[model samples]
Target: MGMPSHLGLDDFPDDVADEFPSDVKLALFRRARAGAALRLYRRRGWNDHAVRFQYDRAAAELAIALDRWEHRETNPTLF
Candidate 1:
């Protein structure tokens, strides 16, 4: 199998699938943020500072789930 294509967070509302439920989209967003952060940390050679930065940012994004929650709550019918 080939290495997967690079996926951007913007690739989808969450999962690139056309019909994800709001809840599933939010969950996927969190997972993707964390996954991306970890990858960035590794690319930085996992230096303590880089790891901490990536981990913290990812945690904050995942914890609050900023974009998904805000959009879903504020524009419940938009998407």
Candidate 2:
């Protein structure tokens, strides 16, 4: 899928959100927040160290979100 021109913390379809547990939703929220921060730092030409920190944080958050999403079905009681 093509990337959106803009990003927001609450980007998913509202109806779909009800299907997942709170932990999964929270993971996605964190991932989106980190991604937005990373994008902003890069666009504003922030210091390399700051940008890299956001980059790493965003990557970690994304991994966490993906893992939660994938495992949610098998472990519905996960937090």
- Give lDDT: candidate 2, residue 73: 52
lDDT tens digits by residue: candidate 2, 51-74: 567656755665665566666555
- What does candidate 2 score in Cα RMSD to the true structure? 6.2
TM-score of 1: 0.38
lDDT (C-alpha, whole model) for all candidates:
0.52, 0.59
* Model 2: residues with Cα > 4 Å off, grouped in runs: 1-12, 48-72, 75-79
lDDT at position 26, candidate 1? 55
- Cα lDDT tens digits, model 1, 1-79, are 1111223345334334445445545555656766776777678776556556655665554545445655665687844
TM-score (C-alpha, index-matched) for candidate 2: 0.53
- For each candidate, how many residue pairs have backbone atoms clashing (under 3 Å)? 0, 0
Write down the TM-score of every candidate.
0.38, 0.53
